[model samples]
Target: MRSIAFLSADFLANPWPEYARFRAERPVWWADEIRMFCVFRHKDIRTCLTSTDYTVEYPFRVSRQVFGETLLDLDGPRHQRLRRPLAGLLLGQRDNIGFRAAAEDRARTAVAALRPDTELDMVRGPARTVPLTATATFLGIPPERHDWLLHTVEYLVSHLDGSSGDFARASALRAELEEYLLRLISTGAPARSMLGEVHSWVRDGRITAAEAVGLATLTLAAGFETSTGLISNALHCLARHPGHAAGAASDTGRLRSFLKETLRWEPPQHDTVRFARRDTTLAGVPVPAGSALKLVLASGNRDAEVFDHAEEFRPDRSTHGSLTFGHGSHSCLGTHIALDVAEAFIGALLARFPGLRAVDDPMPPITGSTFRRPQALRMWLGPKGES
Candidate 1:
């Protein structure tokens, strides 16, 4: 009982050792307090993700009062219907070429803005810079409004940190997001952007106004942090491994490997929970219906049975594939966009600044928060052409 309480409170504080123990002792252990079964094994993680027996609860019911119903929480045809407009908006065939170019172009612009011989927080500068403009391009928000949009999202998302389960903060954010979406919709800008299309879809009776607001808010919430964390994690890796960074800088061919390894080393989305819709067996354990299951993706990625030297950050490791973007029907919709931004930013930074290293005070430490990310990354921007 005491151990379980400790796991609940400090799971984020020192998860690696706990994960290792769970992997060896009880790969599919149940936590009575949270009433959720956790998967720490490589195979169990893969199986839980790949199997259709489980269901995800985005704005999870307890959370729905705050987030409302979006595709993140839906299943079956309802989810399919809700995703159609977003599919065309976020992942359509026609949208892919343009969005990719637009994202990369925005990344190039951010890189150009970096000041030589000046140390800075990549999170505020390039990290926020890349996603802010890219999301604006996708949603048709003007670039000048980037700061406000980011600020709003930042405040709201900050609520989601280790303490977001609070009712007051969640309600406030949800109310503000609702009003913002309503105002944006009332402007009647049905052009080439997602907001416009969502408005048009709502007008056509494809989705309700509430649904549109929920989905839009979901997109806004998920857009920045994912990209930001990935870049931070990559920089954390590159700064520590100059050799790997240097090699990848010379040949962009190693970009994919670096990205894969960084994901394994420090995955952005650490865990995803699913509500057990019905009693089912997972990894040889019986899970009762309505029970919650938390899949520790970071732990799964580092499972010793799955990868050799699972704890070490090895760019050359071949089993670098991961469910960090999730798996099955609930897989992240922005995967390609995320990769493009991460690869472009990391690849460009390494190529441009060869002497980048973590600044001592705000150094990138593995945070204890469930979302495994560096809270801040301060890199020393050395004079060019010197080690």
Candidate 2:
């Protein structure tokens, strides 16, 4: 392993320029700070993602603490078994009319509550509420428990980012969340919900009760946070390019492309880690067993070899796909649900507030190293008559 200096704080705040440099100079290099081999190029990252030699079993200390042993930390048949039932339910939910309509209704209601001609924090308004509501509704979380669920999810996500100062509080919250889920399962409330489905799997001896808790925790936390980031990031992108927002408002195809471009340009979760199970060569660099590879999905999305004008956010740009939601076995199961959430929220926002514009001149800073999104999107809602 080749050791190098730690990445600077500024690079973590805004990493694209640094990523460009790495792509040009050393696309694959070892950083001592994180103790992981960082892969920058698209092809190499894709290769690492699909390769059987690399597994997602790298020690994600915070995730393990908060979520227990989830599918994210498993590999081989064990991972497949845990993922199968949940994946089937999620895939089926994607095409369910009731689920989609409920999501749209939630998005519409959230956006409609914002008064025109007033500045609003998009994060606090639609971005945060829509996904939380949608996920809870789909998971069959009771209305009374929605507030608790949201708060717990936020707390869990903070720990998942691995930078939270209050680990003790996060640990307490994780315990509380687990207990709450166990009770919810026992009560048999929302018996037809995903949690109920998971409980059924447990009864059938497919997985343990603890595994069910973990899967439920994973669904509640992962489902909401990433979806929240996607909505917030997409809004930030649209605010920066008003013309695209206008085009997207009237054209469904353009709106879909706009969301795709946002995913490519500023993916919510920046990178994911994988552990080398055996000796391997990545981009011709020798990787030893038990080494961690930080697959920079954000960098791969902007690789010059794969994308033209890689730095610019052009909604109309043609593309095959981006690594935003990852690839292969560990690809996001909620990809379709996330896209649906974005479509519903963006469509509702554009319809309700025709001339939405960013209130901050430069806009709020996008933050986080492991996870990235606008801290808060302050936007001015144009008068009802304005277009």
Q: In order, what is each prediction's RMSD in angstroms?
A: 3.1, 2.4
Any runs in candidate 2 off by more than 4 Å, and if so which? 1-9, 93-98, 385-387
lDDT of each: 0.73, 0.82
TM-score of each: 0.88, 0.93
Q: Residues 222-271, candidate 2, lDDT per residue (tens digit)?
A: 77888888889988888788788889999878998898888888888889
Which pairs, if any, clash in model 1? none
Using alpha carbons, what is the TM-score of model 1?
0.88
Judge candidate 2 at residue 131 and give its lDDT.
88
Worst 10 residues of 1 by lDDT: 1-10
CA error at residue 257 for candidate 1, angstroms: 2.3
